[model samples]
Target chain A: MASFLRKNRPLLVTLLIVAAVLLWMTNRYEPKVTASILLSGLTLGALYFLVASGLSLIFGLMDVLNFAHGTLFMIGAYIGFTAYANPRLILNTLPFALALLGGAQAGRWLGGLLPARFKQRWQDSSFLVLTFLLALALLFIGVRGFNLEKLVAATATATGGVVATDLAQEAAGRFLPRIILLAVSGLFLGLGLSRVGTAEVRQRPRWTSAGVGLILVAAAFALIPIRTPGEVFLLSVSSNVRFVLALVIGLLAGAGLGALIESSLIRPLYGRVYYQLLLTLGLSYVGGELVKSVWGTVGFYMDIPAFFGGSGDNCPSPNLWSWFSDHCQSINVLGRPFPSYRLFIIALGLAMFIAIALLLQRTRLGIIIRAGVQDSEMVQALGINVRRVFTLVFAIGCGLAAVGGVAAAPFLGVNLGLGLEVQLQGFIAVVIGGMGNYVGSAVGALLVGLARAFGDQLVLSGIHLPWMDGVVRMSPSIARASTVLIMALVLLLRPAGLFGKKD
Target chain B: MTNILEVNAIHTFIGQFHILEGVSLTVPQGSITALLGRNGAGKTTTLRSIMGLNPPREGTILYAGEPIQGKTAYQIATRGIGYVPEYRAIFRALTVEENLRIAERSKGDLAKRGDLIFELFPDLKRFYRLPGGQLSGGQQQMLAIARALVPENQLLLVDEPSEGLAPIIIEAIVAALRQLAAHATVLLVEQNFRMASQLADRYYIVDDGQTVSSGQMADLVKDRPLIAKYLGAGYAGAGLVPAQSTTA
Candidate 1:
């Protein structure tokens, strides 16, 4: 691991900081509570994996950066829900399956329907414009007629003149819209990943699928709207920062997502970096607007899952909002009670992560995927239609991302900017993981996750340092500043991402 | 005679360099015609154009007497013509068996014509387990010839079979070409005058994408200048008629 770190200097620096911060955060001694916090992290990471995987597969196979991958993912969700109108059906497994299949078929059809000039137009820089069109189309169609529910009619009508709405932030994030959005997202994730067998994508990444399944189970519970009881777990003796843990975990999660997105999508698009960046920006705008269209833009409200809900309390679980509701901790050196529940969620997240690792390494499918990833031609010569494999891999990747979204939505509250917000973090994770390396990607995800958590806490503890943007002169924000700064530094110090071997 | 393969003044351009400039050739019914040329000659380009892997910028390629210039490689391959590239372009990752399977003309192999290939190249039977990448130089040459034997026992475009092979293997290949000519029309591209003179029934010596020399095998073997200028050697001891071998 140390040698691995040395080879991946940028990843190393990130890992050390992240690990140190996680250790520091946990030092508060919320023993029983750490599990749930980790679980929360894992859930969030899973969703990132879904999107990152698709982007990764596309980039690896086609040598094209899908700047609008997130938008496509989001579109899958919309199409799925369009097929199945029941909000409750999105919650049920059978309905979700049907919708997911429908959505994936739509994606495949759309994929095939892409201009016959795909070889020429899709290969050039102008491809970004196409992505922008796709994103814009999805947002316009998805958001405008979401409540209209006439499925084909709304999507096909094209010119359902924009509803004159003066609604802003506080007015949007409501009950019905949030539920609909959640179902749409789940269906999208499932559909995106449905290509495992059909697409022959990267030889069926097993770990990602298993991890996705586990995450789905967790999300199903989260989406249950059912009440569950909880108990106070073991306490610690440290009088340290409880809120500090919350802020740290939040910021770190954000940073990791940012990193993963950058490397998987943004990094490889450097040749057409302008197009990718522009596409990301355009898609992000669409995503934000879509969110605004759903709820009214105030604050999202969803019933907490039984796992997070308090014991027999009418109101859902009550713990610090910082980390996921894992357990309460004994440490409080900084004046706030350490969040035991959120810490537990993080622990769950870690366990979920281990599942992902085991799935990637120990499976036959994984072996085939590894071979295909290295040299697809070698695998294709074996009579496997590699194109189908690519499609499956992309779908699986997208599924993992959707799982992450559903799992994280409870804590972060799914918003329009949520995909883009975490998009950069995912890119950061890719850099941390090392470019295109599976183990590297996981390691990178962890390091960036912990780093962001630490950086956020560090900033709050009387650190008045102004951070730089990714480039020397670029502007920066507290939330985005550290991630971009770290990425820029990593890129400069080592061209290959920290954990990545030189290709 | 019904010409099995015909190239009518075909021209080809790779990027900017004009290579196949109005070159034409014909393989008479069931005859082994040698496409002889020096290095940097357009023999390879002509084969490529005829196979439709590289389309002629201006001209027509008639196969079994049909215009097949603009067809895809697979389309051409499907239409009873098998091309063995100069580089021995075997699917390297595939085992020798798999490579054969891919090339095994699904439609044509059913007829006992394929048995003739195994009889000709029994060495392929011995090293059948090995991957195409692991084959020795001689074995690969045999495999390249065997690969063309598929598709259809109709028209085989064997490019430079005696190229860089040992004399022993060349002799074996010569014997196989002798057998092959009985069933299929053979278009053999060769630099080795001795091998071409022994196997080919007719000669079309191409240089710089133009047919520089053309005649019967008897005529080509007797003309010492033809041998010296085009083939780099002369028929000394053996009479041109006796050396004809009647092999191809």
Candidate 2:
């Protein structure tokens, strides 16, 4: 009996703490309210797990503390929102894609024309600078020549002298010639830029990337005729299909951006911890600003998909079985009503957890990753390219963050502050769970989630003791600070974190 | 025998400190060549330089008659060179099977050579499912060598394989290396002069990051003054030098 107790002491202690918390909760509040709070806490925990798991994995394998992780989350939300509601915005933005590709190619071409000595000295930096200047020039031309407000007003005057949101279609049609000219100039810019970097010219010309740029230019022209206003096309598709599409697109965009960032920014700065931190922090700021520039500063809530019974004030049925047939916004859980979308969030988190666990435990890639965490240099010497694995892990981490963002859209609403808010929570969870420990992050997230929920409830309803006459209330800020307090407590007791190995 | 690997005046650095300055050596095909040096004499660094873990900034490394100095570690490994790093740098968290699995350069290489590996160290077959960390020091060394043999490597860089093992374990490792030397050329780094004299056909003495002497192992065993000067009198006094110089 003693041996068994000694073996399972950590597990037994955790259970005891949970039981004590439950006993106190049942003493102070109604069972239904407690149950409702528990459900909400789990939902919040699920979101935290999605964000924290990726952060932990990235840090574990690559030793990169990615500040831009939250930005990837925010980007996911915006991408999801566009795919669901304003998909026309994506179609209208084709010219920018063309411009970017054209500008890059032009930068490369222009860089190739520089003297060999200068090219050899500057290398990648020269091409980067050339591309940046060309991009700025293109942005200037876009803002000056095709200002949206001016075009709207001019189109209104040409049509009937009254402004309307749908008037963007006619305005865009009128500037078709100018749009074509911009695309052509972008292609020319790319060709010119390609010449300024001599290494690319000395090495073989990038026929494949150049071909992709040409295809984008062709696509820009093809897509111009079908450009419609964003809101007008919203009613054509089912919300369920749109939501699924949003999720897939959000995941893909997140992964693509992650790969791009790791290869272009983080790859060059490997082993330089401070530079990586600074670069990622700067990227987060720039990303948030970019989102604001495109999507505006105001926060917006996504419409709940019809499969989750759509949005409403009250649920029609309290029966659990009615969930299948009825279009209810809320489901009854333990006789307490809860948002059905939050339940879906909980399910998504569990599924992600299982998938990641299986990936780490069952696959050859998992073996490589596990070994990499100990000594990446050794793994590299063992005939595995650890650098490629680092990039893949980074992309996967970012993709998971984006998944969390898209999932959080309906529950918490999409906003600029959402990135920083979740990022702080994720960092706390990672620290409490133990840095780079995957399962620990999930457990830490749950603890933080539950503490926050109970703290909020305590602030709102106050706690009444058997000996005390009335309820003792505390400030709401305590609830906000609960996660940090837990983190501090965990650090004090177990310095390496709950599961972190002593180095 | 023809030389399979040749490193010429190679200079390697770890961070800012120059670890391998003007170090050079050669390994003959199908033979065990011993690199004898004291602790902190850049013996391990020389092995690392050949493996491309810390590639040399100067001079050339010719592997089977092709330059391989500037190549990355994985590239060097893929070119048929295997390394068993010092301290048995096995992935502690990985199972024995998983450790060997990761070392396979091509698919099914492990299964194809499973018989040979099991024949070499039978204990590994018994503990295949266990994590590498759970193994004893000697067992871990066996697993490390087993990992290097998984791929069809032409040359093996084995570093101090008997450093922390018991005498009995060292004898077992020596026996295993004798069997392995028939299949692949080995460049061994050993502090134990006795083991070096037993297993090596040729020897090179490195001091202060440069090769100071080279000759047949029989000659190294006979020369008492040379052994005392380079390997320290402690090694000579410890009876590491064999009494019978004509044994080899």
Whole-model lDDT values for every prediction: 0.54, 0.80
Q: Model 2, range A1-503, lDDT digits (tens) per residue?
A: 99998755544665687689978888777898888778878988898898899999999999999999999999998878766665655555645565555445444445455686765555445664664566567556654545444332332132222234454444565546655556655654554444442221122235565666567666666666656523345436678888888888888878878987886578768789999999999999999999887777777778888888644554744755777677688887767778888888999999999999998989988989999988998898888988779889899899989989998998888889988888888889899888999988898888778877888888999877779999898999898798899889888987867767778
Poorest stretch of ten by lDDT in candidate 2 chain A: A153-162
Q: Please write out the lDDT profile of model 1 over residues A1-503, one tens digit for every residue.
A: 87775655664566577677568557743543344344434544555554554455445543545555554444333323222221221222222333332333343333433454653445354554554455345434434433322322222221222122112111223323433433344434333333222211212233444444445434434543321110001012111222222223333333333434443344344347567768666756675565455333553322233333444321232434532343223222133343333444455445545664565455534434554655554334223444445545554555445445544444565445556656667767676455666655655555455445444444444343238333232222553566667667777877776655565
Error of 1 at A341 (Å): 17
**Which residues of candidate 2, in runs, are more than 4 Å off?**
A1-12, A94-235, A310-316, B238-248
Q: What TM-score does model 1 score on chain A?
A: 0.51
Clashes of 2: 29
**In CAPRI terms, where does candidate 2 land?**
medium
Q: What is the iRMS for every candidate structure?
A: 8.6, 3.3
* Candidate 2 lDDT by residue in tens digits, B90-143: 999999999999999889999999999999999999999999999999999999
Give the chain B TM-score achieved by candidate 1: 0.89
The fnat scores of all predictions, in order, read: 0.00, 0.76
